[model samples]
Target: MRVAFNVIDETIWFIDRPHEPWTVQAEARAAGRLDDERLRLAVRSALARHPMARARQAPWRFWQPGFAWEIMEEPQVDALSIVDCPDDAALARIRSDLYGHPVPLATSPPLRVRLAHHAAGDVVLLGVNHAASDGLGTLRLLASIVRGYAGAPDPVPDVDPLAVRDLRTPLALDGLPGRIRHAAALVTELRRPKARIAPERAGDGPGYGFHLVRLDAGDTPALGSRRPPGATVNDVLLAALHLAIAEWNAEHGAPCERIGVMMPVNLRPPERRNEVVGNFSSFVTVATDPEDRGRPETTVAAVTAQSRRVKAGGPPGALVDVLATPLPRPLLLKEVTWGLLPFVLERGLDTAVLSNLGRLGEPLSFGADAGDVAEVWFSPPARMPVGLALGAVTIGRWLHLSFRYRHPLFDPGAAARFATRYVGALDRLAA
Candidate 1:
C-alpha cells in the first residue's frame, strides 16, 4: 500500500534538516517493570494495527507528483530498545543522546520506542517523525501499544488513507469570497511584528535541549480557578506563555515587541478521530497588547477574548488554502521554503508555540506486570526561527510541562531558567 504525503506532511518533510529534525516526543512513566520481550511483541502488534505508522517514504521518481509512504509488513529495524538507566543522571544522558538522533524517514515505522529502566521504575520514550503523525496521533499509537501489552484486543479499523489526508477544515471556506477573506487575514498576520528569544553566542552545538516541570497535582485545579470567566485552562496557559516570553526577553535585555504565539488547533473531528493518524491540525496565531504583558489579569482577559474570537471565526484554513494554490514541484517547494524561511522567521513566525494536549482522556495500562502509567509528558519539536516551544499534557492529577528549545537559541542552563520563569508566571496568575 502506498499513501502520498499531504500538504502539512510535505511542509514538515521539506523543512526538516539534520540539525533540526521535525519530531514529537511522548514519555510514559510506569510504576513497575516491563518485560522486554513482552513490550517488543506488544509494540510489533500495535504497528500491525496502525499500518500507516509502520511505513517509510517510497523512493520518489522525477515524474511523481508528490512523495508517498510505502507501507511495509513490519519495521525494517527493531523499533524497541531496553536501556539500563541506574539513576536520574544516567537516564537524562541516555535520553538526550537518543533524542538527538532523528527517527529515520527511510526506515519503516519512522518512530522509536525505548524503555529506560531506572531503579525507581520504567520510563518509555516514544519518538515519531512529525511528517508521519502529530502529537495526538502519537498518543493514539501509544494507546494501541498499551492495550496490546495488556492482553487486550486492538482490532485494526478500515481507514481510507486519502480521506484522512483531506485538508478541508470543519469550518472550511465556502467560496471565492471566503478565500479572499482568508487571504486578507493572512496578509494582516504577516504584517504583524513578532518577537523571539535572542540566540546566545555560546552553545554546545545544534540539537534539541529540554527541561521538564510538573505542576503539583494538588495545585492543578488552580489553573482552572484562576482563569477569567469563559477562559479555559488552555487560554490561561497561553496567556502565561505570552507574559513569560515578554518577561524573559525583558530580563535578558531583549526588546519588548509584540509577542505572538502559534497554537495548533486540532481539526480531527470526533467521527473520524480513529481513522486519521497523521498531521490533522491547523494554526491560529495568538497575540496581545504589549501594555497588558505586565498585568497578568489584563493579559489573560485579552488572550481569552482573542481565543474566543478565533474559535468563533472558524477553523483556520491557511494550510488548506496553501494546498489549493498552484505551486512548483517538491524540489522547488523545498528550495523556495528554505529560501523564504529567514524572512518568514523575522516577520511572520510566532515568537513561541504552546501546544496543550489538555489531558490523556483514558488511562494507559499494561495489564498488571508493567503496571498502569503513572504520568505522561510530551514535548513538541522546537524548530528554529521560533526556537522555543512549550508542550503540556495532563495525566492523573499532575500537569507535565516540557520546555523544548534549540541549542543555539538556549543552552540547558538558560532553558531551565526560562522554564522557571514560566512557572512563576503561571503562579502569579493563580495568586
Candidate 2:
C-alpha cells in the first residue's frame, strides 16, 4: 500500500539527509520504573494502526513519475533503544542524534525512541523525522504508544483530508474574491523588509549546540500579562526575542538592519489539534522595530500589534499556504521560488524561528509503572546558515526555554550568553 505525499512532505524529504535529518527532539520523564516490554509492545501496536509509521520512501530521481511512501506490514528499522548513562549525558546524546545519528529515512519508521537510565530516573527521548510528522504530531504518536503500553484503548485515528474530502467541510472559501485577497496578502508580506542579523564572518560556520533555561510557572504567565491588553504569551515572547537580538548586536558590535522572525503557526483544524499528526503548520514573518523595541514596554506593544494581525489570518501566514499548496500549482515557477524560501531561509542566514508548543495537549504518562510527565521540552532543528532557533514548552508551572544553534555563528559560550540575555529580557518586564 502506498500514497503520494503532498509538496510540503516532498520538501522535507529533500531537505532531510542522513547527517542532517530534519527531526524533532523531545524529552519526557516517566512516573516510576518504565516497563521496556510494555513500551516495545506499544510501539508495535501503534505502528499497526498507522501505515505511515511503517512505510518506506521511493528513491528520488528527476524522472521518477511521482514520490510515494510504500506501506509495509512491519517496521523496516529499529523503533527504540535503551541506554545506561547519567541524565546530562543522555540529554547530550539525544541532542547529538539530531545531526549526528541519521534516521534511516528510506526504510525505517519515520520516528525513533530512546530511554536513558540514570540514577535519578529515565528520560524518554523521541526523535521524529520532520517528513513524517511535526513536533505536535510526535506528541500524539507518543500518547498512543503510552496508552497502548498501559493496556488502554488505542488512539483514535486522525482526520485525513484526502480520505474524507467529500464528507468534510471546506476550510476556506476559494472563490475569486478570496483568492484575490490571499494573493494581495502574499504580495504585502513579500514587500515587508527582513532583518539582517550580522555575526562576524567567521561566526557563521558549521557545528551546533543546545542551551536551555527554565522559568517558573508564576513568571511564565507574567510574560504575557505584562504586555498590553489582549497580547498573548506568544507576543511577549517575540518581544523578548527582539530585545535579545538587540543585546546580541550590542555585544557583537555588528550593526545590521531589520531582524525578521518567522514563526510556524499551527494550522491544524480545531478538531485535529490533539489527534492529527503530520505537518499542519505554516510560517508567519514579522520583523522587529528598533523604534518600538527601544524600550521593553514599547517593544511588547509593537510586537503585539503586528502579531495580532497574523493571528487573525494575515499575510505572513497566508504566504506560507500560498506556496505550500500541493503540486500542479497555479504558477509553478513562482511558487517553487519565493514560496519555498521560508523552508530554505529558516536554515539559512535570513531569519531565526521560535516555536512554542504552548502546552502538551494531554498529561504525559503511561500507567502505574511509568510516572507522570514531570517535564517536557523540544528543540527545533538548527542547521548551517540559519544557525539559531528557540523552542519553548510549558509543563504545569515551569516553562522550558531552549536555544538550539549551529556552530561558529554561536559557540556554547555565545548561546549561554544569549540565554542569560533572554532571561534578562524577560526580567525587564518586572523592572
Candidate 3:
C-alpha cells in the first residue's frame, strides 16, 4: 500500500481539479440482499487483501520522489457498510449520497456502499473515489467482496503478480508518422467548435441525473450484428448513442450538427487488465456527424470504420508521452496540472463519454448472503468540460445502461429522456 502515484494517477488527480467530490458510482441490483453486517465484514476482508484500498495520504518531504498511498487500519467494518432506504427514493438517494462522498486523499479507503430495498429486491450502490481507483477497479473490489461474503475461502489471487512491464510501452513499434498525425489531429480538435450541450430546464441542480434501463435478451445480442458484420457491440452502442444525442438535441431546439464521442478504453495490457487495480484507461473519440443519425446503416458503418482506424493507428493511449518522462515529482505535477488540460478545454466541450465495461465473464454471486446479481449499472465520471456520459454493462440477457450528466449542461430530467431516446435509437439500429 506504500506505492507512489504513477503518472496516470497523478493526471487523474489533477483532472479531478479540486476534487469536487470526484467519484464513480455504480448500482448492483440483486434478487436477495445480504445482511448489513455480512456485507460490511466482506468488504473489510476484501480491504485487507488489497491494502491499496485502505491506503491514506501520509506525510512526505518535498523531495521525497513521489506521493505515496500509506496503508491505514479502520476502526469499524460498518464504516463502508450498507443502509436501507425506501423504494421510491432509492435512485435519487443513491446518487445524492454517492456524489457527496469523495474519499478525501487523507481518508482511509476511498470507497463506500449503500443498499436500498425495493419490493423486487436490493440495489447496492458502490461509490469509489476516482483519484484512488477507476470504475473497473471498484467493480473488481465489489466482485472480491461478494466472493468473500459468499464464503469462498481465500478469494484473493494466489499467484504472484506478473513482472511490472510499463503499461504504455507494452508494444514496441516505430510509428512516428502516426504519432505526428495524432498530435496534429488533437490540435485540430481543440481549435474546432463542438456541439452544443443540452439546454437546462428549471430546477436543475448542480448534481448529475442518473437513469438506468435494461435491454431485453433479444435486443442485447442483436446489437452485435447491427449492419456491419464484424462490428462489436461497443461500436454499435457508440453509434446509437450518436443518434440519441442528436435526436435529443433536435427535440430540444439545440440541434447539434456533429457530436464528439469519448470512450475510455482499458489501457492495461491484455494480461494485466484483470490484475491491475487502478485508473488504467485512456479516451478514444470516434467520429459522429449529423448525417449519420438519420441513416442507421450509415451510422453503424461510420462508427465501425472510425473505430477500426483509431485502433489500427495505435492502442487507446499511444499518444500520452508522459510515460517517457523522468522529471521531479513537483515539476511533473505542476506541468500536467497547469499546462495540459485547461489549454484544450477552457470553454466547455459538448461531448458524450461512453464507457462499455461489457460483462463479468460469470454472473456475480454473494455466496450464502446475497444471491446472484440481477442487474448492474456502471457510470464513469461526468466531470466538467464534458456534457454527457454513459456506462453500459450486460448481465445475462439484460443490457443495463446508465446516463450521467450534471446541470446547466443537462436538465434534471435530461438523463431520463436521453435514455429513452437511446433505447429508441438502439431499436432502430438493431432492426
Candidate 4:
C-alpha cells in the first residue's frame, strides 16, 4: 500500500544528548555486553541484512546515505545542567527547535547518532528518523547489528526492499458503498456519546514517567483462556482494557457507556513480511459501548468478531489503490485531498488507540554474548488534539504495554493509576 500522509513526512525525531546517551548501557546489562567494535560491526551487518537500509528510491526510500555523528568529549558546561533531565522534557525542547531547523528537501540528514565518551566510558545516542522505521524495525536493526558482532550468519533470507512489483495494488472495493453503509449501521449500534472521564489523579503533576513491568510466562495462562476457537493476546488485552475503563468510569461517578479503540492494521501481505520499512499500515476503530459490556463473555466475543471484520474490510488506502492506476497527478491529489481533508480538519475521529503488533521474532542480540530480548515496549505519539495512545507488543513470551497521553490532558500519576487498574482488571478476569 502507498504511504499515509503522516508517514510521508518524517514523523519521528530524536535528540542526542551526551549525558544520557548511555541509557542503552543499562539495556545492555539486560541483553548482553556492550563492546564498541561489536556495536559498529552490528550496525554494518544490519545495513547489509535489510536492503531498505541501503535503498535509494521513492516511497520505499528507507535510510539516508550518511548519518549525522558528533563526538562530544567535553560538551559545553550549559549542557551539564540538562544532563539529568527527563527524556520528555528533552524531546519538547527538540520539538520547539524543529521549527527553525533546516530540513533539506532532496538530501535530508540521515539518521543521526551521537557518540559521547567521558571518564565513565562511551555511550552512543542513535536517533532514528521515524518515517523510515518503526519500533519493530529499530529492534531488528539492533538485533542484526548484534548478530553481526558475533559473526552469526543472517537468520533470514535477504529480500529486495523494492521487490514488491505491485505493492501499490489496492484490495478490491467492489460493493464498497454497501460495505460503508453496513459499517455505518454497526457503528450506529455501537455508538455512545463521549463521556468526560475524570482525569488521572495526578493530572496536574510533573512530566510522565515510564516504568517496565514483567509478568511471568507461566502465569500467562491464568490471565484468561483463549476464546473457544482461538483469541489472540491482543484480544484478551483489549477485553481487559475495556473492563478497566468501564471500572474507572464507574468509580468517578461519570460511568462511560461505551469506549472505542482505534486499532492499526498492517496492510503488507505475508509474502512481503521481510521488507522492513516505513508505515505501510492503516487502521479501523473497534468500539465497545456499554451494551457490549453487559454480558462480559459476550463483550469479549463481540469485540473479537468486530476486530476480525475491521481487519478484513480494507480502509482508505485500499481506495487509494484503485485511483492511483488511472487518475493523473492533479486528480489524484484532489482525490486524496477530498478523502483526508475532513479527518485532518476534525482531528482524528477516534477516542483512543490500541495498537498491538503481536509477537516480534527471536530475541534480538547485538554481540555473540548477547542474551535474548526479554521484552519490547513501543510508546506511540500522542499527537495534539488526540489525547491517548496505547501500544503493546510481545517479545519472547512477555507482553509489554505503554500508555501515552498529552501533557495537557493527562499527568504521569494518572497514567500510572490507569495502568495499575488495568492490570488489576486483567488479574480479576484471569481469576
Candidate 5:
C-alpha cells in the first residue's frame, strides 16, 4: 500500500531553489560502442535494474521514477566541454537558475541523464532532482546501471519509498532545555569571527577549469597522530574548516567570533539499508570562535561531545515532528515563527556547510574488462546564505575533497588558497 507523505518545511526550501540542479558526469573511454541501439538497450537495462528510476510519486510519495536521456554527437560536444566549468560555478548556475525556474511539485522528474558522446568516448551526465534522490541514491542508480549492463541479477529488489518507516518520531526530552542552553553556550564559546570571501564573476566564456586534490592513505596515519580519541577524519576536516574560517576572518579583519558551520546528519539506519532513497537528512550547526584559545584537539573534542549530546537528546527528531505536523493556516504561521529558532540559533554563523560521505567501498563495475574505477566525488547544493560547501568521500584509500562555492562570492585564487590552507591545517593536525 502507498501513502502520500506531506512535504515538510525543509522540502519547501528545496522547492524554492528550482535552478539548483544536482548533476553527475561519468566520462570513460568509449571503446567504439556509441550506437543508438546500444544506448537504448543500456537505458532499458538500467531502468529495469534501478527500479527507483521508474517509481512515481503522488502528493504524498517522496519520489517518482521519471528520467530523461539525451545523446549529443557534435564536434562541439567534447567531454571537457561537458564538464568545463568548476563544479561550484555549475552549482551556482543551477541555484540561480532554480530561483528563476521554481520547479513545481507536479512537473519535475526524479532523475535525468544526458549523454555527450565524442570520437574519444562518452560522458554520461546524470541529474537528479534534489527533492527525491541524494548522493547515495545517485550512486545506487549508477551501480545498478553498471550491474544491469553486465547482466547481474538485480542487486536488490526495490523497496517502495512510502514503505520506509520515518525514524524521526518525536521524543520527550524534558531536561532538553538545559542541554540546548549548554549546546548554545558551547557554540558561543567556540564562535570565531569570519569574513565572507567574495567570489569571482562569471566570465563571458561558457565553462571554467576543474581540478581535484586527493589525500593519500599514507597521509591518514600522519593526520591521525594528532586526532584526539574518538576523532575521525571527519572531525579533522571539520577542524580544518574551522581554522580556515578563522584565518579568512583574520585576513579580512572581520569579526572572528560569529562564524558557524552547518553539518548534515544522515538519519538512515542499518535495517533500512535498501530504503536508500530521497533526502533522508537533517543538520546541526557547529559554532566556532577563533578567539577561544584551546588547542585544535581540544576544540574538536568539545564540538564532538556537543554533537553527541545533541544527537542523544534527539532534537533533530523533534524538529522533524514539528515540521511534519499538519497544521491550519494560523497554526502553520505559528510553526513558521517557531521554526525561526534555527536562524536565531545560527545568527552571525558563517555560511559554510560540511558533509562527509565516508568511503564508497569497491567501484561499481559492470562486466567491463577494462577501466577500473579510480575515484568518486559529489558536491552538494550550496545555495545563498550558505555560500560555501565542503564535501568529502574516500574511494578506496584516496580521500577526495570537493569544495563548492558561489562564483560571485569567491574567486579561483581565493578558492585555491582556501583549499591549500585547509590541507595545511589537516597536515598540522596530523603532525
Candidate 6:
C-alpha cells in the first residue's frame, strides 16, 4: 500500500540537509554478544510487523502532486551488521560513526542496526531517519525487534498512517477558530526576546558529538523525591536543564536573559496507542523569565506552571493545528521554514530541545542464550541554533541520559564540561 506524507513529515523531509540529517538514535548495552543470524532474522521480522517502518520513499518530480511512500515486503538493502570491538575506545568510535551517518531514504526500511562486540560488554545501536519516525516510534520498533528475537508475535496490526496523524494534538479545540486563536497566542508568547547557549567555539560542520551518562537505580528515589507539591519528575529535569544552562553561561561570561526549551509532546490518543510507525508529536516551548533564573527551586516552580499550561492545551499546541491545514506542499514548506520557524530560530525562542522518552516500559531480552539489556539510551538530532538535544529514558529504575551536540558549537571537551554541569544541577535538585 502507498501512503501520502503528512505535513509534519513533509516539513522534516524538506529541511533534511546532508550536513545535518534529521536522525534519531537508540543504543543498548548488553551483557554478551548477540548471534548475527538470529539478530538479522529478528530485524526483518520486526520490519514486517510494522509495515510503515518498512516504507521506501516513492520517486517524485517537480510536476508531481506530492511525495508518497510505498511499503515493501522486505528491505531492499542490508540493514543489520555485527562489528567486533576489542576495546571501549573502538566501541566509542563505532557509536560516533553510526550516529553521524544519515539513513538513506531511497532504500526500503530506513533504519540502521549495528551490534558492537566488546570484551567488557556488547552494544546494540539503532538509528532511524527522523523523517520516518520520532524517538518514541523508534523505541516501539526497537521493542518489536527484541520481541521478534525472543519468538514473540507482531506487536500491532497495520493501520492507516493518515488516521494516526490526524489524532496528533489540539484535542480540545472546537474547530478552525479555536486553532487560530491558540496558534496566535503561542506566536505572541514566542515573540519575546530569548537567550541562546553561547558556543564554546565557532563552526557549523557535519556530524554530531555526543556523551552518555547513567544514574544507578539507587539514585532513582532521589530524582523522584523532592519535586514541588505537584511537579512531576519531568518538570524537575527541565528545571535542572535550565539551571545548568544559566550557570554554564554565567561561568563563561555570557548573559542569560531568558532560557527556552523546545520540548516534544506525544499526542497519540488511547485508540491509536498501539500504532507506532509515524511522527505523532507536537512541540511546546517552555521558557524561564529572567527572575526565575539561577535557582533550582524557583526554576522548578516556574517550569511546573508552564508545563502544566502546556498539558492543559495551552499555547505550545498551536503548531499542531497550523500544520494540519490542507495546503499545497510547496507553499506549506515555505511558510514553515521561511515564515514561522525563521522567526522562532532567529529570536532564539528555543535554546535547546529536551525529549524525555520516560521509560522503555518493558525490558528487552534477546532470548535465554543471547545478551540481556543492561542499559538503554536515545538521542535526537542536534540541529544548529538549538544546537543541543538532551534525551532521557529509564530501564527498570536506572535513568540514562544522552547529550548530543552539533559540530563546532560544542567540541568533545565542551560537551563533556556542559554535561558535568547538568549532572551537578540535577544533583542539587535531588539534594
Model 3 C-alpha lDDT per residue in residues 163-218, reported as the tens digit of each score:
23234454333554544555555555545566765665734355566766778756
lDDT of 1 at 390: 90
Against the true structure, candidate 2 reaches a TM-score of 0.85
**Which numbered prediction scores highest in TM-score against the true structure?**
1
Per candidate, the number of residue pairs that clash is 0, 14, 1, 3, 28, 0
lDDT per residue, candidate 6, 1-431, as tens digits? 77877656776776676777788888777677677888789888888777667988988775465678888888898899899998877877787788788888888988899988877667778988887888888888887877787786654745655456544343447777777776676676577667778789656668787888888635644376644567787887798889888888888888888888888877776565535777777777788977897567778889989888877765454555666655554544454554556655468467888999886656787767665778787988867667889999888878899999887678878888999999888877753
What is the number of residue pairs that collide in model 3?
A: 1
- Residue pairs in clash, model 6: none
Whole-model Cα lDDT of every candidate shown, in order? 0.77, 0.65, 0.66, 0.47, 0.50, 0.77
Candidate 1 ranges with C-alpha deviation above 4 Å: 153-162, 169-171, 199-204, 272-275, 316-320
Off by over 4 Å in 2: 17-19, 157-193, 196-207, 224-227, 314-319, 324-349
Candidate 1 vs candidate 6: the TM-score winner is: 1
Quote the lDDT for 233 in model 4: 65
Tell me the spans in candidate 5 whose CA falls farther than 4 Å from its real position.
1-15, 19-52, 55-105, 116-123, 157-159, 165-167, 170-211, 222-226, 273-275, 291-294, 310-322, 325-350
- TM-score of structure candidate 6: 0.92
**Candidate 4, residue 33: CA error in Å?**
3.4
Estimate candidate 1's alpha-carbon lDDT, on a 0 to 1 scale.
0.77
| Ranking of all predicted structures according to lDDT, beginning with the best and ending with the worst | 1, 6, 3, 2, 5, 4
**Residue-level lDDT for 411 in candidate 2:** 63
By TM-score, is 2 or 3 better?
A: 3
lDDT of 2: 0.65
TM-scores of all candidate predictions against the true structure: 0.93, 0.85, 0.87, 0.67, 0.71, 0.92
Sorted on TM-score, best first, the list reads 1, 6, 3, 2, 5, 4
Per the 3 Å backbone cut-off, how many clashing residue pairs does candidate 2 have? 14
Ten contiguous residues with the weakest lDDT in model 3:
159-168
lDDT of 3: 0.66
